[model samples]
Target: METSIPPPKRLKMLDATIKRHQYQQDALIEILHRASELFGYLELDLLLYIAHSLKLPPSRVYGVATFYHLFSLAPKGVHNCVVCIGTACYVKGAQVILTCLEKSIQIRAGETTPDGQISLTTARCLGACGIAPAVVFDGTVLGHQNPELVSERIQGWLQNGTN
Candidate 1:
């Protein structure tokens, strides 16, 4: 998916960054941030390269990446949508909202639209059960969401590029 940037070129960039950071093990998170920013996602190849570059085990790199919600392993679309599927949210029609989103965006859960404009994701819980049926567009959480309002907000993002 990162075909736009050649792997060798990315490695070269990583090498420079590692050298600049002095390859300190503590810079792992910063290195990861750089890698993610450069490549748009942290693929295994990128993580392995980072570990090798930093003289750390691949597992450590992966552990850090997976531990933080700020990091994403999969490529994201221009816009991100994470629907809550926790029990409380589900009971409040979160699944209906998700289904409507899938239909409207023409992408199933865990997928980005063909146009690369929308990524549909699911979270077991957003810890906003009090609001139930929450949807996060980009990074802002919308509580008490219904299908119509979610669709309207998505349309707004499609038209305006912000939510």
Candidate 2:
């Protein structure tokens, strides 16, 4: 008798996405987006599977994943907070907001909270320069942010336990 282990359901879904894209190397970015959507974050093993499935070099896949700010190799928390440090935002005091959040949460950029409740990260640009000093909280971009405003928002999350 012969038996084979079945792949995890999520992996199967990722495979389907790859198949839908015809496994074309040029479709890498789209496939990666789907994979990230399905997996929350792209771990090394998942990236390897993708590289192997597309017959591309692991290094190449890794490079692509790392090159894009949208891709995250590490696990994200329930609530995501991304501070934009673009020139416009910086000049508008985005750095001060970021610093306040870090001090309030006791976690640096790219690090998740100890409780896994929030993930703090920074972005080069969110393309909302007109609103400069923008911050993204749980996917909703809030513009013209200040340190006090951000701190209050973080407090609400901490107290309400909401994402």
Cα error, candidate 2, residue 70 (Å): 2.5
Q: Write the per-residue lDDT of candidate 1 for residues 1-163, one digit (tens) a residue.
A: 3568887797788788899999999999998988887788899988998888888999999999987665788888889889999999999999999999988888898888777788888887889999998999888998999999999988997897644
Q: Identify the leading candidate in terms of TM-score.
A: 2
Q: Could you tell me the lDDT of residue 50 within candidate 2?
A: 94
Model 1 misplacement above 4 A: 1-31, 54-69, 160-163
lDDT of 2: 0.89
Cα error, residue 88 of model 1, in Å, equals 2.4
Task: State each model's C-alpha RMSD to the native.
Answer: 4.0, 4.9
Per-residue lDDT for 1-163 in model 2, tens only?
Answer: 0014234777788889999999999889999898888877889999999999999999999999987878888888778999999999999999999998999999999989989889999999999999999999999999989999899899989998974
TM, every model: 0.70, 0.90
- Clash counts for all predictions: 0, 0
lDDT of 1: 0.87
